[model samples]
Target: MADNNNTLRTGDVVMYKNQYRATVSEVNADAGTVKITFDTGGASTVPVSDVKKA
Candidate 1:
């Protein structure tokens, strides 16, 4: 499998669920999760593997 190391970070813009645009609010490498907030004011803590840089 490919490494997810260089894929994300806080303040980076990304697309989630293939639908909404979101900004990375936090990244917890130790927990393998990324916190993001969508343009619509919703937020979530998703697995690092599920997020892709926009």
Candidate 2:
């Protein structure tokens, strides 16, 4: 697979684990992680590769 760096960004809508839709609160390029705030009022730090545009 190709590198997906920079594919996700803060404020972008994404689908995460379990197919939940969430908004990206932050992006940590150095750590390759993203902070996502789910629509259901929850958040998590997940690997960038683990999420995709909703």
Q: What overall lDDT goes with each candidate model?
A: 0.84, 0.86
Q: What are the per-residue Cα lDDT tens digits for candidate 2 across 1-54? A: 334553887899999964899999998878989999999998999998788888
Worst 10 residues of 1 by lDDT: 1-10
Spell out the clash pairs found in candidate 1: none
Best by TM-score: 2
Runs in model 2 lying further than 4 Å from the true structure: 1-6
State the lDDT of candidate 1 residue by residue for 1-54, as single tens digits.
345556687999888877778999998888888999998998999987677778
List ranges where model 1 is wrong by over 4 Å.
1-5
